[model samples]
Target: MPKLHALELVPDEAGQELVRRDWQALRDAGLPSQLDHRSPTNAPHVTVVSAPELPEAAVDVARTRLGSLLPVRARASGVLLLGGDRVTIARALDLDDDVVRRALAVRVQVPDRQHVGWLPHVTLARRVDRSSVQLALDVLGHRDEVLTLTELRRWDPDLGAVTWLAGH
Candidate 1:
């Protein structure tokens, strides 16, 4: 099996912490949540692109491609439920922002279905049951929050490392 490498945009501390709080809320409510993933590499982020395998030079290429688009101000509009069989609860990021869309457009094309288009979300939970949708929503109320995207990162699952690419 090939290692999965994801190119993503990460928000500042405030934004990350807010997502963390949401995860904690869901977990405390005994619901499926990202808090279950205790890996050091796991955190709140918007995936720009993902592939089973990417060249070693991908970092540099991404940096050059998306460097100037940093510090993008985006909105975490509200809660989102994605997927067909198993639902995923997430905080929806605003794609209407041209800067956010342009930055995400630097994604490397991959053949995976999930990578076909970007919805720009910070996942809160996965495999949430239909019965628990309302409960999850209640736990995490409407979030009309702004997030300042400050960095681009490469999350290499094989190496379990998050390498900083651009921004402070």
Candidate 2:
């Protein structure tokens, strides 16, 4: 299937540093895809909305309407287990509920996505074993950091590309 347009939060200094730190921890623990920012999928981000496909016009409109919300204070906790055994291990992040609403208001173009009650997070590892999860917890303990989200990003999953939308 062709990739859809996905909107995401691009983190600032603190967040990026956190990602780098986390990546190193994972690498030290002999995990896969660590410090692999060269791959878009491995890049640090928190996706806001994803659709099968999106129009260029809608993206531009969203840029204009949601531009001011940039530089959001993104907060994340240390370790969060998102699924059952061999599930996704992630760090929890939160975007404002209202902002999420506006993003979904445009989701009519793309269906099969549940925008409400969304739990925003940055996946540290996916389908990891129990031992790996413990290693991650041991490496990265419970911590809090503020991520200054200066811009929203448009991600193309199939192409592994990201387009940054300007914000002030």
Candidate 3:
């Protein structure tokens, strides 16, 4: 089977620390009860593009395109409701030239859809209900924060593994 792949904007160590602290505060306040079942090490991150499957050469292409691209500042803008099960914290990315060009080159075809726009967002919690999400928003108070895009990741579905291909 073809693997699922995504181009994501990962946080740096310092950024991750900030996110961890925020998560802890939320957890302590009982805003993220759903997180209790998951590991705390699963920090926050934003995805640029996701594809159901990629060509075998996609990784190589991604690596080449990403290697020289410098890291950029991504500022969180607001909170968004992704689905009933998930809530997204959105960020505005200062994408590098190569990053933008490379992302535009990749095409994703979702069934029954003509095209889906690429929306950049970092997830706060999964399997969350509306009440829980409302609690989280109330706790977070403000919808904005600044984070850095530090890495790109590749995920293999068949192997059920994720690999970090680039880091700044």
Screening candidate 1 with a backbone cut-off below 3 angstroms (N, C-alpha, C), the clashing residue pairs are none
The sequence of per-residue lDDT tens digits that candidate 3 reaches over residues 68-129 is 46365666666656665555433244444666666554433223211376555566555556
Q: Which ranges in model 3 have alpha carbons more than 4 Å from their true place?
A: 1-4, 33-41, 85-101, 107-115
Q: 104, model 1: CA deviation in Å?
A: 5.0
lDDT digits (tens) for residues 2-86 of candidate 1: 6678888898999898888999999999999998998877878988777886555555656776666677777899888988777
Q: Whole-model Cα lDDT per candidate?
A: 0.80, 0.68, 0.58
TM-scores, in order shown? Answer: 0.88, 0.79, 0.71
Q: Which residue pairs in candidate 3 have backbone atoms (N, alpha carbon, C) closer than 3 angstroms, thus clashing?
A: none
Q: Rank the candidates by TM-score, best first.
A: 1, 2, 3
Better of 1 and 2 by TM-score: 1
Clashing pairs in 2: none
CA shift of 65, model 2, Å:
3.9
Give me the runs in candidate 1 sitting further than 4 Å from their true place: 56-58, 95-97, 108-113
lDDT, model 2: 0.68
Of 1 and 3, the candidate ranking higher by TM-score: 1
Best by lDDT: 1
Error (Å) of candidate 1 at residue 11 is: 0.9
How do the residues 106-128 of candidate 2 rate in per-residue lDDT, one tens digit apiece? 45444544354456777776767
In model 1, the Cα lDDT at residue 166 comes to 88
